[model samples]
Target: MPKSSLVAALSALALTGCSHADDGGPAAIAARAPLQWRSMATPHDRDRLRDWRKAWKTALPRARAFAPERTAAEGALFNADLALPGATPPIGEYRCRTFKLGAAGPAMLDFIAYPWFRCRVTDEGEALGFYKVSGSQRPVGLILRDSPTRAVFLGTLVLGDEQAALQYGADPNRDMAGFIKRVGDRRWRLALPYPHYESLLDVIELVPADSARETP
Candidate 1:
């Protein structure tokens, strides 16, 4: 069966509403995760999702080694433990950029930052949709509320020539999970760790396009 079909089938059996219990590991934390994410992430990815700090610890120092000045200049963009309240970003266009840290392979750069691109956040009833509309590699996913300080990001990447994104569980290699948090009044970030790609940690900084110039 297709992953999307399987997800739909299984979702029928999983608890449909929020569960206040925080025990019994990732599967038990239904209230904090989207339906697709809870069903799709591997045990290891779930651990990565819950304890994302490990990825930060592993990546930040390596990035700093390569570009201390640049890394330092990023400030909260590079801070792993700086999530603030009001994790959801308002629906609208945003100026976003990718900052990769800790190369996964010897041939890749330890730290690399990309220029700003366009992204959007949409209200999807059960969750908010986040899509990077500009870039060779784009991320499109649902942002489900996790806590007052953060939200769970469950989505997949859209590579060149792809007209539409794959279902979150369709391809484990393309699957992306992370935390979205508000770092400042109008600044938000999606922090993905130990991605199935070149970087150990990928931070996507987002700010309202209209107010990008005022970001501090």
Candidate 2:
């Protein structure tokens, strides 16, 4: 299929509703979140999060080969093992940008850098609510505290003007799982490995929205 047609098809799928036994409201979503979030992710996502280091290793050089300046500018963001101690970010608005590395197919670009977008980290009783408020493909979900240096992000993508997001485990195609880590003083990164889209890994760099209105 042509690229436009493929995108249109994906948008259609995002708007369609599918019944799921596990799908429920926010409270219910939080209730199932504990250690169960790991099981909620697809098998591939599980492996992706587990072998995230490999994803970075395979993607960085490939991305550098094509967009060396852009890739090099990322600096510490590309370091897979540079996670800081405090993985949890405070409740507030954040400025985030996306860097997609390693093309998944011939039609995709080797590296793509998206401009700044608005994101929010809310205090959702059981887990923090992470929402990419502005973007064509928004990911809204719960951030469960996993360890001292990391947190597990379990969420699904919301496309276009869709008001509702799919349940995390409802659709494999829409499901998103990643690890959130604080990389700098007030900077954090969400590392999503082996995504189901155009890139092998998706790194979202985030910082307080109050900072300079530029890339994080």
Candidate 3:
């Protein structure tokens, strides 16, 4: 999916009454400051698989016992220009950054705000999908820290009616607890499972060219 399409899909979701304006103030203010989207950086290592597993262990203590059993075929590797269903056109680019998690290990973080979409089977085996436009419901964004550990963290902002969001967030079937128990802290993790291998685009700020700008 193109970045424009992703944005359109997300906007449509919002229009469908999936999100409520922040209760603090005027709706216009809320419109000006939409959600923000970002992802954790990718670690650079000769043994990425090993690092991933280690990270997962740090974040998820019971990973060996509770983590979803995924074959290499089931795992999807994402690039800077990955696209998904319902993505907006003109997918944006991304800025990758690396961070250190102290003794826990080195982590990578990427801040992206472009058109992206994802449809995945949550750890609990339920279907979870999203069409992301500008920002993300997840605060810290998606974290893919250690390779050997295969630790991953995701923060999301709940969209849609309170009931729907809450229901998904609290879904027991999804293996959300294992993921959250390892990484959930100041940033809350939804009890619901999130789709894996969702599509994503680059990050780009929307700004009209000077030629298209009106004269002052």
Candidate 4:
């Protein structure tokens, strides 16, 4: 599948709602994540990623052990962008950023009013999808990162933000449990935190495509 299609397929399996907003601006923040900003993963990051892989392998036997959802819309509200039948909201575009090279100070948890790392909160036909828009020059992998549940959608938004944050160890912290939320019309947020890398949580705010501003 095409890269964008891959993102859609993976997220659709778990996604399902929100407000209407204008189309967000172009990916102006994309420039910040220039090629020079990229870097290799740290040693600790490699170890943790290995662990995550091991865990996934261990869980493979039970990947299909859970019962199907009782209703099509049971977990449809994984986020506001998820379409709840007729009440679904439009997906928004986000600008992403990461703190890979080094933080100006100790990592702080604060609202990023500017575009650093952004992802699109996709509204699938009956599901929703999301993925990176900038940063790492890699095709991000999407996986359900939370405990098994029929009504929840959780995954990492990696290789993208900074289009780099903790960049948290490895790929979007497949273990960094997080989800989507509606903040306003044509606006949403994906509150994903890197597993164990608390200082680098991703509260990616999304603005509607219509809200996209011309690059200055």
Candidate 5:
């Protein structure tokens, strides 16, 4: 799909946390754990929390980046092309945004808003529900699913909103489940998910929350 349209679709999808699935079982579970929270403390028995701001800032350039620079018409056409079969909601447009991480380079972030639909059957031979991304294909998203559910903000590893983080210490969308403690300006440490402390660094490249705002 055209880059422009992808952004719009993503934005819409982000606004609405929908998914395309034949079974509502997952959805039910997700709803139950919609938003959970935890805390990160030092001297964990297994995991060691290290600051990743420097490494993330260093890898910015290598990461691909994109920004919004087209008209709504262009975005519309792009979305149409991406709206393929099995595509939920059929995303139509999006706004591209970019976040620069010093020497690391720039990371592309899109704001999309759309619908989700899915179809599935239950064990009792009952037709399950249908879920799909509102404006695009299935709702393939990266969410932090700790005891609670925390939606990861698009193009950023940080929680989509403060409420998500405050409610659920770290983001559940990420592979590693742990607490995120800010050490410096835009810098944070992964306080959980033993053996994968470095993996958190990878997410930092995807979402540069450090630069979003200045920390005391």
Candidate 6:
């Protein structure tokens, strides 16, 4: 074979081997994406939240009866002094926004005109148990599972209080959950499938409340 052809063949082989090592298969990439929100807040290219926000608003009133209910048992689960970052919302008020792990994302999600939850903590340690589900002021349960480094919060049911943390855990296989990776960090994602099942969207973002002019 010609020297040039031989060299080209070697290069192609090297490239193939490299790609196989980091194949970046679709499922593998998507799997790591959920954890990516811990450091960055990337939104999907289409920003489906814009479209879904409208749908959430349209269905808010009607979604009440179908809303998940928060129970007394859930509140006692993580009530202990568990060390988790941003376990409590934050000192400054923040509004929850949709979060993702891809291109065209927001550093601080917009708290303006979305199913966002606006909240704040105090100087003393006040942990955030749960926030309202999208659309309505009612909370869709947050079950806590604490680890040495992170706290796993599963959104299970609905809380009646408009401005309180969800302090419990219930359904597991039938709930959507998120992890707070940072210690005392409030920036996390909540993959909520509220109003109904089959809506496993990850567009939620948690940004400071006074950070912007957009208020509910």
Predictions in order: lDDT = 0.77, 0.77, 0.24, 0.34, 0.24, 0.34
Sort every candidate by TM-score, greatest first.
2, 1, 4, 6, 5, 3
Q: C-alpha displacement of 191 in model 5, angstroms?
A: 19
Q: What does the lDDT read for residue 103 in candidate 5? A: 26
Better of 2 and 3 by lDDT: 2
Q: Candidates ranked by lDDT, best first?
A: 1, 2, 4, 6, 5, 3
Best by TM-score: 2
* Off by more than 4 A, model 3: 1-26, 37-69, 75-163, 167-216
- Residue-level lDDT tens digits of model 4 in 63-176: 213212311122221232342222223455655433111111355322222334555546433234455666552223332222222112333434433432222223433434
Q: What TM-score goes with each of the models?
A: 0.82, 0.82, 0.21, 0.37, 0.21, 0.34
Cα lDDT tens digits, model 5, 41-132, are 21221132233333343333232222244213222222211222221111222111222222222232222212212211111111111111
Which residue runs does candidate 6 get wrong by more than 4 Å? Answer: 1-88, 99-127, 137-149, 159-176, 182-186, 191-196, 213-216
Total backbone collisions, model 1: 0
Runs in model 5 lying further than 4 Å from the true structure: 1-24, 35-52, 60-94, 99-151, 154-216
lDDT score for residue 110 of model 1: 92
Better of 4 and 5 by TM-score: 4
lDDT of 6: 0.34
The residue-by-residue lDDT of candidate 2 on 1-216, one tens digit each, is 222222222223322343553354433433443434564455666877888888889988899999988877778788888889989889999999999999999999989999999999886655677889999998887777888999988777888999877655558888888999988889999989888899999999989999774653
For residues 1-216, write the lDDT of model 6, one tens digit per residue. 222222222122223323344464432333342322212111221133224444434333222223223212122211222234444344455566442212122332211124456543233111233444344443333223344445444333443444433222223332344444332233443433222232323324455665552322
Q: Candidate 5 vs candidate 6: which has greater TM-score? A: 6
